[model samples]
Target chain A: MTGQVRTVDGRVAGRRGQETRQKLLDCLREMLSTSPYRDVKVIDVARMAGTSPATFYQYFPDVEGAVLEIAEEMAKDSDTLKELVAGKSWAGKSGPTTSEELVDGFLAFWRKNDAILRVVTLGAAEGDKRFFKIRMTVLNSVAKPLAEAVKELQAKGQADKSLDPNAVSGALVSLLASAAEHQKAFTSWGVKVKDLKPNLAPLVYLGVTGKKAPK
Target chain B: MTGQVRTVDGRVAGRRGQETRQKLLDCLREMLSTSPYRDVKVIDVARMAGTSPATFYQYFPDVEGAVLEIAEEMAKDSDTLKELVAGKSWAGKSGPTTSEELVDGFLAFWRKNDAILRVVTLGAAEGDKRFFKIRMTVLNSVAKPLAEAVKELQAKGQADKSLDPNAVSGALVSLLASAAEHQKAFTSWGVKVKDLKPNLAPLVYLGVTGKKAPK
Candidate 1:
C-alpha cells in the first residue's frame, strides 16, 4: 500500500504542503508537454510554478524524480485500460467490438498522456530501470489480461496454439502503443486518421482470434 | 542527382573539410550513444573530436542539425532494408523465410543505429517536422516495399482482401520497430533475446500471408 505522501526530508505532507506539491507537479506536466525532456530543468519547472528551486527540491529529488512521480500517477490511471480487455468476449460478433473498443480506449489514453509517455519511453530506452518498470506497469495493465484471454482461447482451440500467448499479446499491445505513438507516420502513408481504428481493430481481432473478424 | 556536400558558410568543402565534418559527425554519434540527446552540445562533440566549437558550427547549425545529418546517413543505409521485402515471395514455406529474414535484418539495423533512432523517435513525437520526415524516410524504406507485397498478396486472393494493405503493412512494420526499440521489454517479460525472431517471424508471416505460418 502507498504510505502517506512525504517530503524529501521524510516529513508527512499536510493539506497545504500537498497542495503546493500538486501545483508544482501540474506545472511540471505542462512544461513536459511543451518542451523536450532534455531542456526541462528544475529551475525552469520552479519558474513556471512561481516557486523557488529550493521549494521544488523540498518535495522531490530532481527532474527525473519529479518526472517519475508524474509517471506513477499516469500508471495509476492506466488501470482504467484494464476494463478495455478484462473479461471481454472474443467470440463471433463480440470479438471485433471488443477489439474496436480496446483500440479506441488505448489510443485515447496515449494521446492524453503522450508527453510523459514519450519521456518514459526515452528513459526506458536509455536503460533507466525506474522508467522501464513504470512503463511495464502501464503496458501490463492491458497486456496481462489480454494474454490470459489468448491463453484461454488457445486452450479451447479458438486461437492459434502455435503462438506464444505472452508474445502475441505483447506484440499486439506494442502495435497499439506504436500506432498511438506514431499516428503521424500512418498519415504520411496515406492511411487517414479515420482509417486508424477501423484498420487496427481487425488486426487486433485477427491476432486474438487467429482469424478474420466477423463481417 | 546528388549535390556536393558544403559547409554551413555556403562554401564547398574540400577533402580536409569533409574529413573534419565527418569526424565531428562520428564523434556526435558516439556522444549520442553515451549521453542523452538534450545534453549533447557542440562543445562536447568538438572536445571529443579534438576540434573546436567553431569547427562544429562551421559544418552544422546546432545539435539537432548535427543529429539530422547522422540520421540522414543512417537513412541512406536504411535503403538496404528495402531488399528484405522487395520482390520477396510470401507463398507457403517461403513466406516464413521472408518473415525471419525481414525480422532479423530490421532488428539488426535498429540495433546498429539504436541511439540516434531513439532521438529521431522523440523528435518526431515532439512534432518536429524535420525529424518526422527523416524517420519516415527510414520506415518507408521498409514499409513501402512491404505494403506492395501485401497488396500483391491481397490482389492474388492470398491475403484478406477486406483488410487494407497499407494499414496492415504499416502495423507490421510498426510492430517490428517497436519490438526492436524495446527488446528489453520482451526480455523482462521472460522472452529471451534468441526467442524474438522465432516469435516475431511468424507474426509477420501471418500478417502478410493471412495464414498460419507453414512449419
Candidate 2:
C-alpha cells in the first residue's frame, strides 16, 4: 500500500490536508485534459482548485511533479488490468470472448485516464526515467499476466511455440495501447468507434491463440 | 512533385532564401531532439541557425508552423516505407523475410526522423488537425500497401477472409509504430534491441498471413 500522502516539505498530510491535495490533483487532471501539457501552469491549477499557488507548491513542486503524482495513482489503478488476462481461457469460443472483453476493458481504462496517460507517454518517450518507470508499471500490469497466458498456451501446443511469449504479449499490449491512444486515427481509416473492439478483439485472439477466432 | 519552395508570404524562395529556411528547420529539428517540445522556441531555433528571429518569421509563422514543416518533410520521406511491403512475397519462408525486412526498414525510418515524428505524434494525439493529417500520411504510406497485400492474401485464401484487411493492416502498422517509438520499453522487458526485430517480425508475419512463419 502507498504510504501516507506527504507534502513536498516532508510532512504527512492529515485528513483535511489530503482532501486539499486530492483537490489539487483533480484540478491538475482537468487542466491536462483541456490544455496542452506545456500550457498547464501551477497558478492555473491553483486557481481552478480554489487554492493559492503557495498551497499548491506545498503539496507538489511543479506541474511535472504533480503530473507524476497523478500518473502514479493511475498506475496503481492499472492493477485491475491483471484480471483481464489472469485466469482467462484461450480455447474455442471462450478465446474470442476473452479477447473482446479484454479489448473493451483496456480501451475503457485508457479512455478514462487518457489525458494523464498521454502526458506520461510523452514524458516516457522523451527518455524521462520517472515517467518511463510509471508507464512500465501500467504496461506490465497487463503484459506480465498476458505473457504468462501466452506461455501457457505455447506449452500446451495451443499457440506458436517458436515465438517468444513475452514478445507476443508485449506487441499485443502495444497494439492495444496504440489503438486506444489514436482511436480517432482508426476512425479516419473508416473504422467506427463501435467497430473498433470487434476488429481489435480478433487480432488479440489471433495473437494469443495463434489461430483464427471461432465464430 | 512538390512545387518550388516559397516563403510564408507567398514569395518564391531563391537559393539563399532556401538555405536560410533549411538551416532554420535543421536547427529546429536539433532543438526538438535535445529539449522538450514545449520548450522549443522560435528565437532559440533562429539563434541556433545563426539567423535573426525576423528571418525565422519569414519562413514560418511560429514554432508549430516550423514543426509542421519538418513533419511534412518527414512524411514525404515515409514514402519509402511503401516499398517495404508493396510487391513483396508473403508465401512460406518469404513471408517471414518480408516481415523481417518490414520491421527492420520501418524501425530504421522511425529512428532516423524520430525527433520530428515525436513532435508529430504529440501533436496528433493532442488533436491538432494539421499534425494528425501529416501523421496519417506517414502511416498510410505503409499501411495502405500493407493492406493491399493482406487483401490479396485473403482473396487467395492465405489469410482469414472473415477479418477486415484494413483493420488487420492498420493494427499491424500501429504495432510497428508503437514498437519503433518505444524501443526502450522492449529493452526493459528483458528483450534486447537486437532481439526486437526477430520477435516483432514473426508477429507481423502471423498477423498478416494468419499463419506461423516458415523455418
Candidate 3:
C-alpha cells in the first residue's frame, strides 16, 4: 500500500490529512455495513466519518475514487483467495487434490470474512463502476492459472475431455462468486458461515466437475 | 403497449399529465445522449424536459420511476424475444446462431430508445430499494424464460448436459446485462450498435457456453 502523503509539518503529516483519509475509509465501511454501495454518498460518508465536505475533496476526487480505494483493498484479498483456488487441481483417483482443497479454502475464507465481504459485495451485485470492474480484473487474473489447471487435468484425462476446462475454470470462479453473493443475501440473517459450506461446497463441485455429487 | 392516459380533451391526463410525461422521457433521453446512466440524474431529467419539480412527480413517483416505466417496456421486449428463442432448440449451440438472435433483439430495441434505457438502466444496475427492486421484477421476468430455455435445451440434449444449465443460464443473463451497461456507458461517446454486434456476440457466447469457436 502507498504511504499517506504528507505536508511535512511533522505533526504526523497534519492531523487533518491523516484523520480525513482514515475518516473517509471508516465512513465508507460503516455506510457499506448498513447498506449497499450505490446507496452511499460522498456527503453522507463525510458526515458519518465526522469530517467536513472540503476535507473529503482534499483526500479523494469523488465518491468513485474513495470507493475505488476501499474496493481495491478488498479486491487484493479476493485475489489472494482466487490465487489459492486457481493454482491447484481437483483430486480424483490419480490426480492432485486441488478441488477439495479449493472448496475447503474458499469456504473457510468466506466464513472468516463474511461480514466485510457482505459489505464489499455491493460493488459486484450492484454493478457499481468501481465494483463490477474490479471483479472483472480479479476474474481475468484468476483465469490464467485456472485455465492451466484445467488443461493439466484434461491432458491427464482426469477431467472430461469433451468439455472446455478453461471455460469451466472461469465458470467455477463465477460459481463461487455468485454462491457467496447468494449466501450473504439469502442465507437467513445471522446464519453462520458453517451453515453455508454444506450447500456451497457441493454446488462449487458441480460447477467445476459437472457431477451431481452425493449432496 | 399501454396507450397514454388521456384527458377530457383527448390529451394526456391531469396535472402536467401525458404531454409532460412524454417530454420528461424525451428530456431524460437527451440528457443521456452525450453522458451515461452513471452520470445523469432526476434534476437533469426535469431540467431537460422543461418541466417543474411538481409536474415531474405527477406522472411518476420518483426519478427512477419515470425512467423505469419505459424500462419495463424494454424488458417486455426481452420477454417476447425470450419466447421466440425458447421455441427453438439452443442446446450445445453457443455460437453466432444463439447469440445473434438474442443480442440483435436487445440491440434493435436499444437503438430505438437508447436514452430512456440509459436512465432506466441506472436503476436496474443498482440495488436500491426504490429503484433496483422494481428493476429486479423486470429482470426476473426476462431471465425466467431464458432459464427455462436452457433447462429445456439441456433436457433435449441440445446444450451441454454435463454442465449445470441454470448456472450457465444465469451467467448468460449477467453477460447480456454487463454488455448492456458497458455499451450504454462506452457508446455514449459515439460507438455504433451495429459495429458492436460482431465482437459482443462472441464474448457473450463465451460467457454463456464458456466455449469459443476456434478463435
Best by TM-score: 1
Q: Predictions ranked by TM-score, top down?
A: 1, 2, 3
Give interface RMSD, per candidate: 1.1, 1.0, 9.0
Q: For candidate 2, lDDT tens digit of each residue in A45-158?
A: 999999899999999888898999899989999999999999999887788889999999999999999999999999999999999999999999999999999999988988
lDDT of each: 0.91, 0.90, 0.55
- Candidate 1's residue-wise lDDT over A1-215, tens digit each? 88999999999999998988999999999999998787888998888888899999999988889999999999999999999999899988888999999999999999999999999999998888999999999999999999999999999989888778888888899999999999999998999988999989988888888886767
| lDDT, residue A120, candidate 1 | 96
Two-way lDDT contest, 1 vs 3, winner: 1
Question: Which parts of model 3 have CA positions greater than 4 angstroms off?
Answer: A7-20, A33-43, A90-133, A151-215, B1-17, B36-38, B50-58, B90-142, B146-172, B175-215
Against the native chain B, what TM-score does each candidate's chain B reach?
A: 0.96, 0.95, 0.63
Report lDDT (Cα) of residue A178, candidate 1.
97
Ordering by lDDT: 1, 2, 3
Candidate 1 lDDT over B1-215, as tens digits, reads 77998888899999999999999999999999998776788898999999999999999988888889889888899999999999889987788899999999999999999999999999999899988998999999999999999999888998889878889889999999999999999887777878888888888887888777766
TM-score for each model: 0.95, 0.94, 0.64
Instruction: Give per-residue CA lDDT, model 2, range B22-57, as digits (tens).
Output: 999889889999998988888899899998999998
Candidate 2 wrongly placed segments (more than 4 Å): A10-16, B1-15
Evaluating just chain A, the predictions reach TM-scores of: 0.96, 0.95, 0.71
lDDT preference between candidates 2 and 3, better one: 2
**For model 3, how does the per-residue alpha-carbon lDDT over B1-215 read when each residue is reduced to its tens digit?**
57766533455685546667788877865665666445667777877777677766666766556566666666556455454356554444534576777767655654565555444444433344444444444445445666676666566655555445444454444444444534433232233545555544554454444444333
What TM-score would chain B of candidate 1 score versus the native chain B? 0.96
Model 2: CAPRI class: medium
